[model samples]
Target: MMMKKKSKLFVNCEEAVKICDKSQYNEAGLWDKIRLKLHLILCGGCKKYSSSNSKLTSLCSKAKLNALTHQQKEAMKKVIESESAK
Candidate 1:
């Protein structure tokens, strides 16, 4: 029982990153989040990765990214008008 407890308590940097990503998606279990939190306290690389991931997530979330080109939009509009006229 003691060894089991010890073995499950800490995760390595790799596990922490995977867990952190899973956590961002709400896919990680409670125990996984706890273990990830513990690992982040000790592992600087994982912590940095987690922070960067969070920033990327939030930036993507709030960013109004417009990918359509003006030419594409005009072409699409012309297609729609032609279709509607028929």
Candidate 2:
């Protein structure tokens, strides 16, 4: 007969974050998502990161924000400088 080993129930912050990111992309397994939720319950920082990542994803999906062009960024910088001068 063969014996099987059980995986650890709790993961460290680093592993937790990796799992969180994977979960964000819908790549994490069911167990991985459960473990991440458990870690977030104990770690405030991880929870905050998870919230922020979720927000950013939501924003990106709603907006077509594919990085600003160099010219557009320069124009924005100029506008900021002019506004600060006023």
lDDT of each: 0.89, 0.91
User: Against the hidden true structure, what lDDT does model 2 obtain?
Assistant: 0.91
Clash tally, candidates in order: 0, 0
Could you tell me which residue pairs clash in candidate 1?
A: none
lDDT of 1 by residue, 30-69 (tens): 9999999899888888889999999988998899667899
Most lDDT-accurate candidate: 2
Report the error of model 1 at residue 61, Å. 0.6
lDDT of 2 at 33: 90
Q: Stretches of candidate 1 above 4 Å error? A: 1-6, 64-86
Q: Write the per-residue lDDT of candidate 2 for residues 1-86, one digit (tens) a residue.
A: 98866558888899988998998899999999988899899999999999999998899889977988999999999999999999
Q: Supply the TM-score for candidate 2.
A: 0.66
